[model samples]
Target: MSDKNDSATVLPEVTFSTFVLSLASSALVHLGEVPNPETGNTSRNEALARNAIDVLTMLDDKTRNGLTPEESKLMRDVLYELRMKFVARS
Candidate 1:
C-alpha cells in the first residue's frame, strides 16, 4: 500500500546545451509569432512587436555570457527593429 500523498517526481538533467537550445527555440517562436496566425495583421501586429521586444530583453539578460559576437550582433539588430516598430506606433 502506498500513501496517497506520495507523488511521483521527475526531474530532467539541465545542461548548457539544453539551456541554449531551449532559449533559441523560445526566441524563434516569439520572434516569428509561430503560434499566432494573425501576427502580421494590423490589429495583432503591435502585440507581436511587443512579444519580440520582450523575448529579446529576456535573452539579453539570460544569455549575456553565452552569446557569441555574431549572436550579439543579431540581438542588436532585433533590438533595433523592435525600437523602430515601437516608434512607428507612437
Candidate 2:
C-alpha cells in the first residue's frame, strides 16, 4: 500500500496522473526550479527541461480523447505551469 508518511516503505500507486506529475517533477528539477531529492541541488539544463516538456506535450497530444476530464485538465495545467516557468527561467 502506498503511504504518504512512509514513503521509504512504499511508493505512490501507478496512475496516469502520477506518471505525468513525475515527468513534470523531473522537468522542474532540470529547470532548477526544484531541488533534486537525492542531492539537494537545483540545477538548470534547458535542453533536458525542453525535452521533458516535449515528451509531456506529446503525451497530451497522444492521450487526447482518451483521458478522463480531470486527467486532461491536470495535464493541461501542469504543462502550462511548466512552460511559463521555463520561459521565465530563460
Candidate 3:
C-alpha cells in the first residue's frame, strides 16, 4: 500500500554522533544571538557553552557515541565554568 511504502521510505534512525554534531552545530549558530545581561552585548561563547550543557543533559549513555567518559566530564566542567562566569558578569 502507499501508506506502507511511505513508512518504509522514512529515513533511518540517526546515530548519536550525528545527533550530537548536529546539535553542536545548531547551538554554535544560535550562540551569537544570546543576550548578555550586564553589557547588553551578545555573549556567543557563553551561549554556546550553555547550549552544550543542555544538549549533554539530554544525552544518555546510548546517545553519547563518540564521547568517552573523560570527554563527557570535561564538557560538564566547561559548562559549569561558563555558567559561573555568566552569573559573575550579571
Candidate 4:
C-alpha cells in the first residue's frame, strides 16, 4: 500500500509574483538576453520584449500596495533589468 503522505505532495502554487517573473523571463528570452531552452538559440525581438515589459509595468502600477514586499521588489527589479536590456539592445 502507498503512503497517504505521498499523495499530499503538491507543486508550488502559482502566484502573482511567479506570473510576473514568468513574463519577465520570456521578455529576456525574446531580447536574446537568455537563450531559448528548447532550441538552444537566442533571438532578439525588441518589439515583443518591449510589449511584455510594458505589460509588466502596467501590472505593477495597477497592483501597487497590494503586493507583499518580496513580490513588489521582484517585479520592480525584473522590470528595471528588462528595461535596461531593452535599451542596450536598441
**Model 3: which residue pairs collide?**
none
Angstrom error at residue 90, model 4? 0.5
Each prediction's whole-model lDDT (CA): 0.57, 0.95, 0.55, 0.90
Estimate, for each residue in 1-90, the C-alpha lDDT of model 1 and write its tens digit. 556666575445675444544444444444443444445422334565566567667877889888888777666666676566566564
TM-scores for all candidates: the values are: 0.48, 0.89, 0.34, 0.82
Candidate 1 lDDT for residue 57: 74
- Clashes in model 1: which pairs? none
Pairs of residues clashing in candidate 4: none
**Residue 84 local lDDT, model 3:** 60
Residue 69 in model 2: lDDT = 99
lDDT-best of 3 and 4: 4
* Native-to-model Cα distance after best TM-score fit, residue 10 in candidate 3, in Å: 13
User: How many clashes show up per model?
Assistant: 0, 0, 0, 0
The better-scoring model by TM-score among 2 and 3 is 2
| Candidates 2 and 3, the one with greater lDDT | 2
Q: What is the model-wide C-alpha lDDT for candidate 4?
A: 0.90
The residue-by-residue lDDT of candidate 2 on 1-90, one tens digit each, is: 456888677668889999999999999999999899999988999999999999999999999999999999999999999999999999
Cα lDDT, model 1, residue 90: 43
